[model samples]
Target: MTEPRLRELAVADLAALAALEEAGQVQPWPAERFEAVLVSAQHAVLGLEDATGLIGHAVLARQPFDAELEAILVSPARRGEGLASRLLAAVISRACEWGAERLLLEVRAGNAPAIALYRRAGLEEDGRRRGYYPPLAGARREDALLMSRPLTEG
Candidate 1:
């Protein structure tokens, strides 16, 4: 397998990105949504691609005082290969370049691996929204864990 390259995705990448999201996300964003994000000035969509095509992507949004990681997904077949961590590091770099004081993200409380990844990256739990996510297969909702890391080293 060829080494994956990380780069900014353009409008031309919409279809491939949408396909990856469909395959990887339980609640995938529509192609139209991806299109909108692709064209937005405040948003940056980064894609990781290899010879097999797009295998992972992350969405970052610049805010008034910080940057938010709106979404990150790695192809199911590509999971456990540390691709998500690479995408996250890129997001942090981009956020810092934008002079964001901090980076913020929300993850489903049940997503242990993702939470662990964020923790390992120096993000701490800022708070949680109880019953924030709709049920995937049952009636009980799951909480959302809000995490953040200061971009400035101090």
Candidate 2:
């Protein structure tokens, strides 16, 4: 396998993005939502592609004072290979380039791997939204874990 390359994604990549989302996400964002991200000036969609095509993606949205990690996913088949970490690094870099004060994200409380990844990248737990995610595969609704990391030193 070749090294995965990162690049900015556009609306033309919607089909591959949707397919990857469906394969990787328990509750994937709808195609319309992906389209919105692709077209929005406030959003950046970063895609990681290898010889087989897109293996991971991260969506970053710029706010007035901070940037939010709207979504991120690596293909289930390709997990544990550090693809997510790479995507996250790019997101943080982009946020910093935009002069964001901080970067923020919300993950499912039950997503241990993702939470760990965020923590390792210097994010701290901010709060939680109880039952923020709908039940999956007969499981109860999961809380959303809010996290953030400063982009600039005080």
Cα deviation of 94, candidate 1, in Å: 0.3
Clash pairs (backbone) in predicted model 1: none
The lDDT per prediction is 0.95, 0.96
Top candidate, metric lDDT: 2
- Poorest 10 consecutive residues of model 2 by lDDT? 145-154
In candidate 1, what are the lDDT values of residues 51-86, reduced to their tens digit? 999999999999998999999999999999999999
Work out candidate 2's RMSD over C-alphas: 1.2
Q: What TM-score does each of the candidates earn?
A: 0.96, 0.97
Off-target runs (Cα >4 Å) in candidate 1 are none
**Residues 1-154, candidate 2, lDDT per residue (tens digit)?**
7799999999999999999999999899999999999999999999999999999999999999999999999999999999999999999999999999999999999999999999999999999999999898999999999999999962
- The lDDT of model 2 is 0.96
- Model 2 scores a TM of 0.97
